[model samples]
Target: MKKIDAHAHLGYIGGWANVKMDVDELISLMDTYEIETTMICVLDNEVAYKAMQKYTGRIEGCVYVNPLEPDCLDLIDKYVKLGFKAIKLQPLRHAYCADSEIVDPILDKAEEYGIPVCIHSGHPPYSLPWQIGLLAERHPNCKVLMIHMGHGHGVYIDAALKMARRYPNIYLEMSGMPMHTKIKEAYDTVGHDRIMFGTDTPFHHPTVEMQKVLMCGVDEQGLEDIFYNNAKKFFDV
Candidate 1:
């Protein structure tokens, strides 16, 4: 079956000794893993744009927007015009919540453009699930994909699942965190189709992430949906 990695990071993670990668090496890994397509984004906009341009066919680019950046909406507009499939936000890195007033304009723009937004939603310094839920409530038209399911902790996962159950616009992307049981629980609660497969590559292995879902004992059709079909439908791939 064909595969599409719905989330991945391609830029340097400063100070985090474990997570570091350059674009060339990432592309090599994608090729090695037989990933037919990836949703690529970088912490740096210029680098992301260049990498997107470089791997135009193989990667569906998502532009990163720093909520603190001045004239951020203009940059988002420019990239969306450049054919980026979505916008990426790191609320935890910035110590901001998803529903913060600062991000309202960004959410508005995403709704206006009819594209999705991916947010890092786990652990310290990141916004919690309630914040993400509030943002989704405020912007019902915008599609929000929660990265890591709030990092798989008990409280965050519970909040995330509650939000996904309440809002049609919210989705949970599986990556980085080891949450096989929680993922299965989410599937049982929200249905298998609501979850999307992601590697958070360079941190987790794509094939291994896929293996987690397989080992969950979901049927072949459920596996196909998570591995590729759901992302295809989500991004119109």
Candidate 2:
């Protein structure tokens, strides 16, 4: 029970790979990896809801939000009330700025529901760590997970850690990010409790993500906190 993947996907998604995944495939993968729980998001909210229903405890839903759409706010209200655990946003994919007021209403709704928020980080113009940091600054009451903790870039990865240090409400989920040493830097400086392990499934494999943390130079308890305790507590699953 020492693993909980904080960022994962369900259904077919149009991307570089146009990757597709069903619940059974995901469940089998989790079993093979010994992951106790995995938080999932999908382009279609129904898929997430159904998976949650089917698996009960194994699948935790992160209601995906696209702020550019008219129903984005309504979707939050709909899904959160339907038992989705947290809010997931991807600004770059939707062509919106993460720090803009367009996302404020979504953040407000998440606060109302008392759930944590996660946003895709790294990539320019929209999803940079500083941009997400501004949103966190505006809404101090909400918990925000900067997913990827700034992807594969060194500068963005460092920026991600800086944002966490700068904002108390900010937390980091290390998935696509490389650099295992930064995890140690983050744990030693920011706080081990603020960092968590994630596998951006269908995009990044768990082996590399887990290896990053394993080599991050933390103790056994620190590994437990990052792999399981932090996300379990943050998502309240």
Candidate 3:
């Protein structure tokens, strides 16, 4: 099976414990795990885009944009031209919700480029599932992937499914949540085609997260779609 990890962090976040993995180390890990490709993003946009340039062919990435940054659009254009697959936003980190005025231009650019935008969803003390749905409604053409399905709060699953049902562009990425039965329920409710496999690696081991999906009793075809084909189709990988 061709494995594609839809989410991963490869650089250091300010003040967080160091997680600085160089391109060679990242490539070696991908090779060891037989990961055909990984979508790399960093908490810092400058560092992340540099990494994207360095690992251009072997990996794809999203530009990390803090909506609060005054030059957010310029940075977005820079990375978009550099061939980033999407924009990575962590609302919690910047204390800005997806619906904030600061984020409007970012969403506009995402629509303009026809690229997807991934948000760190389910991380509380931050944005919630309703915000994701609202954003989807506000930017009907923009493709949004909700990371972790709002992890601690399972309520986001319903919101994600509702938005997905209403809009063809919304997608749910499974990363932090570990309940196998809930994952299966999401598959049944939203259909396997709308779900993407993500390990949230470096935080959780890829092998272990991959195993969680494998043990879900989903048929091989379903597994194939979740693990690779769906992401391939989504990002044109």
Candidate 4:
């Protein structure tokens, strides 16, 4: 099956303790794990654009912007026109509530441009899964991907599942979840089409993440959707 990583980062984290991801390093890992494609977000828009341009189909760009920043919508439009495939909102990192009015414009632009918005989940008061669901409810036309599926915690997972079940526009990006049972549960509860596989690469090992999916015991069709088909449709790659 052709696998696409729906979530990844190409920048450093936490005072440069982690290695910064680059085109060669990302491609090397993709080659190692046989990942056919990846959707990457970076703090630097120019770096992301350059990486996408250099790697073309192998690395797709996800526009990362702070909603509170001035001309946020303009940047989103500019990057989308430049071939960005999705918009990433890190409410947790940006210190904003996902359901707040400030984020509405970002979500609106995402809908306007016909692209998905991937939100950081699990963190409460800011980026909770339920808060994202509330936003999804407000904008039914928009596609909202809950990255990490609440980071695999039981309480957050329950909230994520509840949101997924309640809102059809809400979808799950599986990564950083530590157990296969959660994957199986999500597949059984939310169905395969709404769930997409992701590695959260550079932070998590691709091989280990793939193995989690493999051990989930999903049927072949389900595996196909999670591995490639769902992301292909969602990201239009």
Position 169, candidate 3: lDDT: 66
lDDT of 2 by residue, 4-122 (tens): 99999987777577877889999998998879889998978899999999999999898998988899988988998889999999998889988999999988999999999999999
Which candidate number maximizes lDDT?
A: 2
Task: Give one digit per residue, the lDDT tens place, for model 3 in 1-237.
Answer: 668888888754436644456667777877887778888777666666676677776688888889887888888898888788999998988898776667778889999999999988875556676787777778888888888776655566666666666766678788887665555666777777778788776666778778778887788887888888878888777
Model 1: per-residue lDDT, tens digit, 30-117? 8887677888778667777787788886777788888888978988999899888899998877777777889989989998998988
Q: Model 1: residues >4 Å from true position, as ranges?
A: 124-126
Q: Write the per-residue lDDT of candidate 4 for residues 50-130, one digit (tens) a residue.
A: 999899999999999999899789999999999999999999888999998898898899988999999989887798888
Model 4 vs truth, CA RMSD: 1.3
| Regions of model 3 farther than 4 Å from truth | 14-20, 157-159
Between 2 and 3, whose TM-score is larger?
2
lDDT of 2 at 58: 95
Q: CA lDDT of 43 in candidate 1?
A: 67
CA shift of 57, model 2, Å: 0.5
Q: How many collisions between residues are there in candidate 2?
A: 0
TM-scores for every predicted model: 0.93, 0.97, 0.90, 0.96
